[model samples]
Target: MQDRTILRTPLCDMLGCELPVLLAGMGGVARWELAAAVAQAGGFAMLGMVREDPALIEAEVTALRAATDRRFAVNLIPAATDPLLLDAQIGRCLDLGVDTFTFFWDVIPAVVRRIKQAGGLVLHQVGSAGAARMAEEAGADVLIAQGVEAGGHVHGRSGAFALAETLLAEAGVPVVVSGGISTGRGLAAALAAGAQGVQCGTAFLATAESFAHDYHKARVVAARGEETVLTDVFVLNWPMGAAVRVIGNSVTQGLGNRLLGHDPARLPREVIAEDGGTALMRFSTDSPMRHTTGNLEAMALYAGQGVGAIRDIVPAAQRLHLMADEAAACLARAAGSRA
Candidate 1:
């Protein structure tokens, strides 16, 4: 069973899902289990397929297919190295029957052409209206306007709703607002402002199927609106420039700009490992995984402003259903008010 009440939007119809809510393709966090759970719950789920091994990516996709027949998207992080790596990944994904994709960072013309040729739907995550226009011209099917308040590596300085408003007026394709959005009220506000849907990342981090560590999840649950800091303090995993929003940990509080002085830490170095032996970076773009060892408390706890509203870890389906029902009721009340 999907959402008990269907709240239809262009995003839901375009994605063939019952609700307009989409699980942001969080690297390492949105694994097969979480993605499958969200998809099964009537929300469109996306797997972060950017930095995974080829075999592992294929295996994850196969596992998700085995779990649910629902269509989900794979998010690609463009590589600066050999284009062959990305081509191989895309080919493997197409072979596995995946049709939708989301791209972050720069837009690769060849990739856009290839996916379009294969009849795949392309959604681009852009921080600004300029990038949105560029992706639309490059044949992107949807645009995710991510605001600065979003967790992880957020690109733009503008807020999500503000970015969405500009994109909706000009981007031409469907626009989904991301960042600082977790509640039905947020969803209604996005829709009321002309957005097609909302892409939630931090909210799903508290779900039972999420791979986030208990300690990390607890931090998110306890976080207030002012507790998160968007900084470049954690730079062990990715490049040095990107700014990510994280809960104020000791590491973030003590080290102001020290990450700028340190080089990106080498992965597979056995610094930290989450439950089930999943290795994590010293300051990972992904959140802390379960049963993690080695400086767990000091490690980066990625979350968004919406963490204020998250209280407990629940099933992803139940969260989606409740949010959908709430959004439906909110929209109904809003319409009646205008009447």
Candidate 2:
């Protein structure tokens, strides 16, 4: 396989595309427009189907279907509180004739079966190699190794680099790497580590199509290496999983004090819903007004170390194009040295 001309992947062949690189599904951020842009640009993109209403998803899916007749997937970040919501979302998406689905949170076997019945592909995300193997055994066609350096809630994994390397030989499925992957160089490194492609999140969130608030996009563009903090900081205000990454905010700042055996449940009750209402999601240009409010220092501002790779706000199409081009160049360089 290494000797083959680095072209579209088995996946791209499956999707009939020209590139293997994908835009990682950013919750709330992977809107229809952005998803279409990436797929149209020849990379598979996925819709972040967390916490979105059925009507909203329908409209977006319809729009995407019209925008570009390319293959893209939809993500369902499983959580308990709104597990039913996921069922509903999946039904609606399948109704829209969507065949590609990605599973996160906890994988649902029934859903996987349903997708397979529809002739769709299932890509599962994992934090470690063992989990990747499990996903493969569970009928997943691909494994996304998410490292600790990734943004959003670290629901599945703890170490990105280790997970990537571990999956190299152990995973029977085609492997993709996520977490802190923000550039063409990172893409090259991931492929060198035995990845078939790369999934980038923070890098996409900084693009012009990203629905992040003006301030949020600016923050990403202006971020330095140490600007991000990973902890259960947003967990207090939100009922999200125990692990998450966000800009160091008051909730995280107070974690040390609360860590000394003081029950966070004993602490004050200022926040309301803890379910998916406040879960960390990527911002999209088409997001509801709820996401537009620049309520920094409180809301979830998920980012990654790759924020430094972002400098300017460009179109999503342009961004995916450049990443693919750079990845091709990098792969060519590696292939040339093999002889």
Per-model clash counts, in order, read 1, 8
On a 0 to 1 TM-score scale, where does candidate 1 land against the true structure?
0.91
Worst 10 residues of 2 by lDDT: 281-290
In candidate 2, the residue pairs with backbone N, CA or C atoms under 3 Å apart (3 or more residues apart, or in different chains) clash, namely: 27-282, 29-282, 127-157, 147-160, 148-160, 211-284, 211-285, 239-274
Please, what are the lDDT tens digits per residue for candidate 2 over residues 250-297? 555666544223333544544422233543332211222224433354
Worst 10 residues of 1 by lDDT: 259-268
TM values, all candidates = 0.91, 0.85
TM-score of 2: 0.85
Q: Per-residue CA lDDT of candidate 1, range 1-339, in tens?
A: 324343678778789897889999887788999999999988999997766777888999999999999889998877332467777888888988789998887667678878999999999999999888888888999999999889888778899988888998897789999999888888878877888889999999889999878888888888896888887756655665667888888867776655334445432244554545666655656556665576787677888898898888899988888788778778788778999
**Best candidate (score: lDDT):** 1
Residue 100 of candidate 2: its Cα lDDT?
A: 83
Q: All candidates' lDDT scores?
A: 0.82, 0.70
